[model samples]
Target: MPHRKLQPGRLVLASHNAGKLREVAALVAPHGMQVVSAGELGLPEPAETENSFLGNAGIKALAAARAAGLPALADDSGFSVAALGGDPGVRTADWAELPGGGRDYTMAMAKVAALAEPHANRRAWFTCALVLAWPDGHTEGFEGKVHGTWVHPPRGERGFGYDPMFVPEGHSQTFGEMDPAEKHRISHRARAFALLAAACLPGAG
Candidate 1:
């Protein structure tokens, strides 16, 4: 099926995460789209019951699209350690959930570090799934990944989640240390957005 083209207009970002909202808003800015986050609109977050990145992204996007009656873009991304057998792939954010209803990424990062300490292989990767959904339930999805080594003690204070620990291949600086523009150039999310842009966004060809 031919992909539907999204015209420049108001688009909803189906996520409550500040970091994701910032990054995604930046990605869509050049395309002449006005971005509004689900949080800003007071849309409730949907449960991510899916087992894969794309699946979860679809859930979020569709929910927001239906609720807001507009096109919605959602991202589901995670950090996976090879030695851990991809233990926290889809449940990446869940790993940071606090008992009192909030997330603490510091604890989450510590858990990842401790679990992988016993293994010599520090190989890791970040995976991102991007989904665009229309109010009528139509959807498109894309996935991307970047592989690198997971470092200890974390690094820069710039990025959120596991960025401080992940060093993309061929680069010495962790995602947390690199400038936002640099990270956006080669990130897993950027790669996925490239695919979506080619397929749907105007002037992206």
Candidate 2:
């Protein structure tokens, strides 16, 4: 099926995460699209019950599109350590869940570091799935990934999530250590957005 082209207008970012909202908004800005987040629109976050990044992204995008009556873009991304047998692939957020509710990524990072301490292989990767959905339920999906080594004693305080521990291949600085603009240029989410832009955004092809 042919991908639907997005007009220069309001686009709903179907995510409640502040970090993700910032990154995605920046990516969409150059395309002349006004970005509004689901949280800003008072839309409740839907449970991500899917087992894969694309599935979860589609769920969020579809729900937001139908509710807001506008095209919605959703991203589901995760950090996976190879030594852990990809244990936290889809449940990356779950790993950060606090007992009393909400999430604490610091604790989550510690858990990951502790678990992988004994293993010599520090290989890990970040995966992102992006989905654009229309009110009528039509959607287009894309995925991107960046492989790197996972470091202990997380460094930097820039990018959110587990970025401080992930040093992308061919780079010494973790995503958290790099300037936001630089990280935006090489991140998994950025890569996925590149595909989406070429396919849907006007003047991008």
lDDT of 2: 0.95
Residues 1-205, candidate 2, lDDT per residue (tens digit)? 7888999999999999999999999899989899999999999999999999999999999999999999999999999999999858999999999999999988999999999989999999999999999999999999999999999899999999999999999999999899999999999999999999999998898
Q: Kindly list the per-residue Cα lDDT of model 1 for residues 1-205, writing each as its tens digit.
A: 8999999999999999899999999999999999999998999989999899999999999999999999999999999999999867999998999999999888888999999999999999999999999999999999999999998888999989989989999999999999989999999999999999999997896
Per-candidate RMSD, Å = 0.8, 0.8
